[model samples]
Target chain A: MIALYRVLVLVGLIGLWWLISLQVGGVIIPSPPATLGAAQMLLAEGRLLPALGDSLITFLGGYGLAIIVAIPFGLLMGAFAPVGKTLEVYVFALAATPRVAFVPLIIVFLGLGVEAKIFIVFLGAIMPILINTYAGVLATDRDLLEMAQSVRAGRVETFRRIVLPGAVPFIIAGLRLGATIGLINTVVAELYTAVRGLGGLLALYGNTFRMAEYFVIVLMLACIGVLVAEGLRLAEKRLVRWKSGS
Target chain B: MTEPAAHVVLSGVSKHFGHRDGTPMAALTGVDLTIATGEFVAILGPSGCGKTTLLRLLDGLLQPDTGSICVGGAPPRPGPETGLVFQSFRLIPWANVRDNIDFALTSSGLSLSERAEKVDEAIALVGLQRFASAYPGELSGGMKQRVALARALASEPQLLLMDEPFASLDAQSRELMQTELMALWARRRPTVVFVTHSVEEAILLADRVVLMAPRPGRVIESLPVDLPRPRWGYDVHGHPSFIALRRHLSERLRELVLTDPGSDFFQRGAPRS
Candidate 1:
């Protein structure tokens, strides 16, 4: 029943798109089926898959590095106030600044290669992951900490049982945000100027005035991005089902 | 059946909180308590009554301003010797029941096998063996509290401090847990200190209920409960002595409540006998 409803919605959306294209006087707005056909052509030629893969690898690297650095640092900041205060403003100031502005400098330092693209992805993803992890750590239940203390839990034991456990939900929420932004950064950096990935393809197709191909690439990217994000969400639910009782 | 010995002694224990200006706000002053090993004692008070503070004092979460607390023959320190089961269950969100219980045994000088064995025993002891792998989010209020109890007990702590462990459960579940607790007590009785607002619960589960009226969080009364064990849910309410005891404590609590805020929650002509 749900599938049928979705299919009906998709049909209606397609019909509306077809009607709009006919009414409009330009080649800019391709019909839904035409856009879908273009999308298929990209898939068949194997260009889209490989480009997506390239984008995905760089995206994961950036997001992965963010998680590695941001989370432990966030934990330290949250668990220890003085340390948090010391490092807090540095991250906050960095996060507040328009990271996009750094792209030019980053290109200068790292060149317009995968390194630059990955760096942008890292910068974009790191803040959400950092902020979320810190929030999660701070949000840990004080009562549980008391309980842990009462049980004669040592410092490390208490952190393991209570502090880290409490931060998991927020950490996952942060990861979701990081992945979303990281994907966008991958495409944005590539579209701006880069050697490989979907963004580079987008720029190449977009500049050549292959409007149909551009539309198709955009659609394919949207699907993959949505699927990856949704997949993470599903994983979060399965892995963090333990959060429900809390 | 016998005289309960004092297991943990708090001598002149006073706790003060520092304000923003570093001025002290007294939470407890000159608190001298002697908790007997294997005895179930309840601390009864209102929301601000510092009953929970006293429990924390025993747990070593907070230090007293001008006194000392000794637990299980040592000065109060952070470790599994003083187990606390929180009113809200406070189960770790990332841990299943088994892992939560296992956490207590992690640093107990026990081998991995020993830790696993202890966890199993604790789970079985709580009658939550079936829910061992279940996450905190999946458990009911009662079940979550049971996990807390199991976790606390797993380390074989000589002292257990409970802050309204049954407070969040429904009345029926609370009553059931009360009996379950009594049964657990009968088997492996630890020197237990429970804090609660429920008048009847204090009488039902405790050997002595230390009542507090709050402002300064001092003990107003220490009433001994002389009820025998093997108590069930129905039996707790049905006994004549239980009724009389409940009536007295409830009346005392009612008096305390009605005196302040000028609003009465009790009936004008409620029977005392």
Candidate 2:
């Protein structure tokens, strides 16, 4: 029933898009068929795959590095009161600052290349993952910790068995948030620095008033967003099976 | 039964906590108690009476501000020889029943096979063998408590400390758990110190009941339950001895409540300034 509703919604959205295209002309808003034709042309020309590959490289590089660095850093902040208290203010300050503000500095240091793009994506994605992981560790049940202490579990053992597992849900939530932001940053990095990926294609088509190809790029991004979100959701379900009970 | 050797001793033990303003609040003051090996003793008191505090002290989770404690001739410290069952169950929500029980045995210096065996035995002991693979979230309140019990038992602790283990359960489950606890006690014969606010529960499960009073919590009376073992096999509550003891204890408890400064009875009856 839900799937049927989703299909209906998609069709309704397409119909609306077509009606708007008819009224405004295809220059501003391309019809659905025109966008499809543009997608096919891009694929036939072999430009779409290479551009997608470049974007994937930038996205994965930045997001993967963020996960590796942020989780452990967050764990340390949470596990030790001194570390958490000392760094939390600075982290919050950095997170509050706009990612676009760092673009000039990042480009100056790294130049107009993939490295600059990766840095921008990392800056955009890191805070949510770090903050959520830290919160997760802090939110571990007091009773569970007491239970661990009662059993004479050592500090490392308790962390491994109880604290880390307890923090899984929070970490996954962070990952999901980070992923969406990271993808956005990927496009931003491409457009702002080296114009070599899907963001570059979007700039080219949009500037030339090729609305159909511009729509294709936008739809490709939407598809990628859907796929990443769905993948994370499945991973979360597997990791937190106990949360759903029987 | 022959007199068993003293397995636990607390002499002049006192514990204090600080209020938000930093004033020291007396949780347990000048408490002295002893328990014979393989004895089932219940500490009964109203809320704020520090029964739970005393149990924590015994479990080595907290240290007394004054005096000393001994368990099995050594200073009390949490180890394989000491098992604690919390009222909240405290079973790991991410772990299955078998793994939760296995967690308790991890620090026991047991090999993998031995720990697995102990876990299996504890699961069977609680009659939760069928649900060994189930997570705590999948279990009902009663089943969760059973998992907690099994976790405590898996370590084969010589001293078992339970803090209101079944107080959260429905009445029927509480009664059923009480019987099962007795059966487990008979089989393992651990020196058990159970804490609860319920008078009937104390009388039902314990061989001795230590009554405590609040406002600087301390033991006021220790009554021996002379009721025979396997007490559940008969109508223990309706027995003449049970009736007499219950009446005396209930009256004493009522008097404590009525006189307690923190109780609503005193709060409502007090003259306004």
TM-score leader: 2
* Cα lDDT of model 2 by residue, A68-172, tens digit: 999999999999989999999999999999999999999999999999988999999999999999999999999999999999988898999899999999999
The lDDT for every candidate, in the order shown, is: 0.81, 0.92
Chain A TM-scores for all candidates read 0.89, 0.96
Classified by CAPRI criteria, candidate 2 counts as medium
Stretches of candidate 2 off by over 4 Å are B1-3, B267-273
lDDT score at residue A76, model 2, on the 0-100 scale? 99
lDDT of 2: 0.92
lDDT of 1 by residue, A30-62 (tens): 877777788889889999888988888888888
**Highest lDDT: which candidate?**
2
lDDT of 2 by residue, B176-253 (tens): 999999999999999999999898999989999999998889999999999988987799999887899889888788
Q: Output the lDDT of residue A150, model 1.
A: 58
